[model samples]
Target: MTDQVATTEAPEDWEPSEVQRERNEWRRRRTLRSAVIAAGSTLLLLGIIGGLVVSSPGWERVQATYFDWDKAVSSFPAVLEGLWLNIRVMALCAVLIVALSLTIAVMRTIRGPVAFPLRLVGTAYVDIFRGLPLLLVIFLLGFGGPALSLQGLPTSALFWGCSALVLSYSAYVAEVFRAGIESVHPSQRLAGRSLGLTYGQTLRHVVLPQAWRRVIPPLMNDLVSLQKDSGLIAVLGVVDAIRAAQIQTAIDFNYTPYVVAGFLFCCLTIPMARLTDRYARKKGYHGAGGHL
Candidate 1:
């Protein structure tokens, strides 16, 4: 009984060493100090900006030109139409990107004789598009389409914008897909094979589904980026939200329409950002073996 008691007590008395405890305490204090300093700096900057805005003479003119509701409302219909075009472009681009990215990702992951060349092609595509700016991609698609003699392509401003978006975004999505695929554990693949599943069958049934869930947050981030990048299409003379706003402001010589357009973009993006955060939290909790 004495031996049993000693054994039990031994485990209970195993505290951290004093030096380790002191180090941990120091880390905690350092973190707290840095957080306070950051917060104080942010508040100081805001106060300075507030003082400047209150004292500035041009504040009223700036507000009138950019923030007047009546002028913004008068341009509502055109803005709504432009927003619809933006949505259509985003949807089409997302579909094409997902399909292309998945195909290239699969090619890159496959083992055997075919993998090398396929990966090379996929790498080249990703490198080229990612290295070039989105604006350049849009301009090339819009202005160079006819030169390439591509047939059955839409000549409408919206079509050109959508094509450019798909081309540019597919490269980015492909890399996201490759990363997700590579993150899947090799043991998972071996287990599936041991259970008599073919390589393709295991990938389809076991791997891709898990990889896709893990990739949702990054993909959602990319989607948000594509939403903002859609504005770049305006350079192609596409009548998207930004272009429509610019046209209205140009004619009226008031910046109110531009403000309305900015608000519209924010309205579209903020909800998506919230949704992505919620989903990411849920995924993290699920992964942690916590209740959803």
Candidate 2:
């Protein structure tokens, strides 16, 4: 009796119940099966369409024109040289577009009576440019700018084409900026105001920084579209990648140069597209509060 010791039962291992484990396994299997089916079905559909096209009578001519690997390889160097001009123009336009759009966005957001004219101008700009076809804008600026022929006016196709891009893209970007600014929590604005910040100071120091972050995905998307649209300058005889490709095609009697140019654009755009998707997904979960 004296040597007897109190005994205690050991706690069981903490683990999910059998039913919960089976449910999780089932869900995992279901997800994997769905993914497999989706991928397989897409591949099958694409293969079937490709087979039908290849089996068609025009396939030979289409391949000769558009898919000649030899011509594509031969055209790469010339297309790349022209692409450098496109890249430079794109870089310049991107800077101008961002600057002008931000200014317009701020003006539009102003509520003071004194700001009425600026707001009206900003609204008109957005409406006009957003509605006007991009190609029409390019054609007007590209051809019309040089036709003026005023002393000291730029006569270069590249200059006017880039100007057209800046004007058109700025309007779209301004709307994106405006939307981002409005999405800023009202509490943030109030907090800035309470901290002795003027409206402009508050917008500059607080609102815009957050707004830009939230809108980065859309902005990047627009930039990518602009990047590709740089090819449109070719129509103005700007000698960009597309123009180079067209010239090469005319010489060789093959459309493969155009394919090369398209491939190059795809290479540039795919990374940007992936990054945009990643940013969108991250923002979906983390959002502006993550910063605070």
Candidate 3:
């Protein structure tokens, strides 16, 4: 028996069976065919739309007014310089909004009769700001703030305009943060408390870290909206990108500079939108298009 032993083993270069290989090849062909069809259909639709637009009677006038290459080139430098101011304003306001909103959220979420006053203030703040249109708030602060002539305070429209932005956005973001905090299981808080942690300690150590993770996607979306609205500071004569575009348009009545400014904003927005979608997908959230 010891002299007679035979073993059967797979070769080191084993391959799929014929049926499996055939199935794989068929799947690959089907996928390629589907992609070709989809792409062809898209190209056909785009071509048709482009042809229709080009054939329109007003196309030439529209192009000259909005798509003038020379105007865009000339205005690019000023518009870009103005954009940096918008970026700086957005950055500073974003930081303030985060801190203020988080404080409001914590105030609203805290329990007990002792916290009733804080909760009331937070609730009132959210209701008032969220109900008011943001543009209106900016107008009030930008135009009316300096009229008060308060001592020791800056009267610059830029300062008040940014303050208005921070106040308005903080209201909306506080609710988002509060929702995340409340979404956590009550057991988490109980567990923290059971470990002899104070309520604030538990929230700071356990609740906030988890809540922050859950709310990041929504927060990013808010930031994108903030980026776009930062251009609204132009209403206060801040000379931001939109304002710079306005100046160029005012010069020769050509709307090309406005188009250029819009294009630049879209450039910033598209990447942020894609990043948000990627992050949401990574966290297992699917959109209306499902996995695709």
Candidate 4:
């Protein structure tokens, strides 16, 4: 007994208790039940409405408007051309918006007396753009361009449309950039400073890369919104998708072409929405591990 050595016990790994496990299972079941109920209710409502619509005389009118194959096919090429214009406007605007947004975001993030004025200007820009309707903005830009001495700068309807879009969307995108910058932790900033990097260097080389990754989903969503908003350029008589549809409608004296246009818009938006959702899921998964 005198020669016996003391034995130390190792710490056991922590595990969930039975009660905790039951609680988690219950929560999971509750979430599943709610989702199922929502899906069932939606399907039931859709079924009821579909049955009623199919049985009604007005169903024929709806079908004629939405499913007139001849009219839709006849207008298809013009609609496709308009669709191309929409794509061009969106792409150009996206480039300009990204550049402007980055500059504004960086200015706003700079701390000190210099930062306040820049931030104020950025805020004003965002407020003005976001407050106005998209249609109004397009009209102003399109019609006012000559007055503003900007008409001859580009001259084309596509140029005017892109100009308006970039002006409006840049403001919104700036906020996204700002939010991404703000999301980077102060500790990380401090760590960068401790590593002898200057503020700008740290932001440029370290923080912004992470922030860009975090902000991708929202940026994608904004791009999708911008795509839809491009249609507003039609108010400028730019012969965009909506305008093409209107022209077809007038020529054929049928509402079917308008329905076709609506379908085209859905075609444009749906893919972008799906892409955004995928990006959001990927972002969430990456974020779950805690700080960047």
Per-residue lDDT value at 136 in model 4: 76
Expressed as tens digits, the lDDT of each residue in 191-229 for candidate 2 is 999999999899999999999998898898898899899
* Poorest stretch of ten by lDDT in candidate 2: 2-11
Q: Lowest summed lDDT over 10 consecutive residues: which window, candidate 4?
A: 2-11
Residue 177, candidate 2: Cα error in Å is: 0.7
1 versus 2: better TM-score goes to: 2
TM-score of 2: 0.84
Give per-residue lDDT, candidate 2, residue 51: 99
Clashing residue pairs in candidate 2 are: none
lDDT of 4 by residue, 115-153 (tens): 798878877888999798777777787877745665349
Best by lDDT, which number? 3
Per-residue lDDT tens digits for candidate 3, residues 1-292, read 5334423555678899999999999999999999999999999999999999999999999999999999999999999988889889989999999999999999999999999999999999999999999999999999999999999889998999999999999999999999999999999999999999999899999899999999988999999999999999899999999999999999999999999889888988878878888898888777812344
**lDDT per residue, candidate 1, 155-183, as tens digits?**
66557767878877888888899899999
Which number leads on TM-score? 3
Ranking by lDDT: 3, 2, 1, 4
Task: For model 4, give the RMSD to the true fold.
Answer: 7.0
TM-score of each: 0.79, 0.84, 0.92, 0.79
**Which segments of model 4 are wrong by more than 4 Å?**
1-47, 150-152, 285-292
